[model samples]
Target: MEIGSFDAADASLKFGAAAEEAALNTNVVVVGSLERLRDAKDCHKLQRVLEASPDKMQLITSVARAMSAKKDGASARELYLLPEPVETDERSGSVRRVCLIALPSACSRHNSPARPHALTSCLKGNAGPGSLTVVAMLDDPSLAFATGCAIVRAFPTWVAQSSTAAKMQSKKINVIFDAPDNEAIPEAEIAVLSWAARAIRFTARLVDVPCNILNTTEFVNQARVVHALLQSTLQARGEEANAVSLEVITGEDLAAQGFGGLYGVGKAAAHPPALAILKYYPPGTSAADQATIMVGKGIVYDTGGLSLKGKTGMPGMKKDMGGAGGLLGTFRAAVGAGVPKKPLYCLLCLAENAIGPLATRPDDVHTFYSGLTVEINNTDAEGRLVLSDGLAFAA
Candidate 1:
């Protein structure tokens, strides 16, 4: 009946703060050729490990190789957490956990995909919930951004499982860029990454929530909540609240508008099928000329209708609305990034593809909103039906 209380603002604030603090306190260790490693500062722990292993290249290359020999057979990465915490600043007697990130010498020429794979693989397994991870800055901007995104993407696993746990678990991990003193990466850039991460997490959570809790009506209501948050943020900044608006069309309105595709697919459910549109029109922007429409499928729960799916397939039907979830997340992120000046529209075609006496069956032909007749050969293909209505309307 509800997706319950998931607050977006609270999540953004918490994640951003944690990431900033974590970046400041990171104990950085640089891995490269022996000449470079010896010249690198603040890598005392790494030096000790090299002393024991006696082979720097082997130590880096065999990070997962040696671990695979253990009984668990777990997938591992090149990042290793030193058993002994190293003194980050000897004068202040400050110490932090030293994590070694291996980068090849002359990394610019390196083109191995395993670099990011190793980074995310290790962090996903070892990093704690709501913890901050700091990696030494990569000279390549594209690589650094990709690594940051990977770090942010890993946080959602915990969020998806948090509801079923005994203690409310945190699924947010802040990944900060650990640049050298000479580097001047702005704080705003890091915050942008946090916003992007939260958006991704938000989308994943919406898709992961059970359909019973996120039915059509509830999904629309959730959109309203997000819109209201946007309105509030705009008002606080003395901007026009009407710049962003949400319009929801459902039930008789859908029928009156001749949305046969949406109606045919959703009429069987207790909650009526709906089309929710979130529109953003910045000042002085012509809605007709400067519009970009984003469409998402919002099948709250797909039971495959009369062409019912097997029990195994039904369990994962909750993710049928992933498109809508991702759209909404992207909407928020775009707004947060302050790039919504042009006219933008997000159309969510929402419905529950449930079975009932009213459900459209095989051999049924429905005239869609665009006046196109579609024969229902199999109700399992109903997602396309609803999406057709959305595309037609948006176009």
Candidate 2:
């Protein structure tokens, strides 16, 4: 999956004014707030940007108006098939699909203007072997980053497919941010959005992959890649002094270092557990500066240890490491954008809570890095144990 952007000049050259050339085999999705789509002026400007035919424009506007009349304040979306099929290259065939997504007027206090959940829902399963262009109508330029993040979340990278199908799944995704009145988004913002999309997809892919493929060892290896990239980036900018450093304490070493919480939970797993730490020091002034530390619970898979989860509860346990994945992605993005001014530390408490003879029992007692002794009550409550070890190490 690729998430990219096109400037006004580039878009005009590729898509043309009326999408005559690009619309043939491409899937196009137009997304915006319901209130904006209801306004005649705003909707007309968007139509001109997409170069939609008069009939298609009418269909889109009518749908938006009807949705607005519901007065229920629920988000709505609709897909329209093009009347004519557009031809593609000799290899792939033609396809004609268009989706219009409208966000609700009502928003919770924390979520305004854009609702990521609604947007992701609208984009799910829209992928194919062809190209997809998303025209996001935004009231503010900064929303473009959020839009990119949401778009990537809808298309996760992990999938179980045959080699032939996997080869055919590679698709092109382009995002065009059209502000109010069809205003052009800046080039710098577009670049940032692209990077953000990449990071988001990276995180989502980690969460989507199964435990067999992405175990504790694999997670540590992935973090090492990010660490190396950050180091290289800092070196390229002539700020080698700010190079990132990584430390890994695994298996028996964790137990030896008093990380009993982490070692206890993962001792029974095939792959030994680990505590991976990444440290980033700014270019200058570090010893006296206060550092910001982040801890992530990277439970590769949770089978509930001795207190096993039921069939219904164990299926989606692959996503237990979401916290670690998110932090790793964010750290990579932050460093890629620019070195931060403050010292930063990221700790990944990685483990797999598998039930076996070596697994922690309900009566087991363990001492954490903080020297606090905890009596095991429920082995299923493993996330807090790893998190406690990470926090103690950070302190």
Worst 10 residues of 1 by lDDT: 67-76
Question: TM-score for each prediction?
Answer: 0.76, 0.82
lDDT of 2 by residue, 267-314 (tens): 999999999998887777474689888899999999999988999999
**Candidate 1: where is the Cα deviation over 4 Å?**
8-18, 22-121, 157-172, 179-182
lDDT of 2 at 391: 96
lDDT of each: 0.64, 0.72
State, as a TM-score between 0 and 1, how close model 1 is to the true structure. 0.76
* lDDT, residue 57, candidate 2: 70
**Residue 300 of model 1, lDDT score:** 85
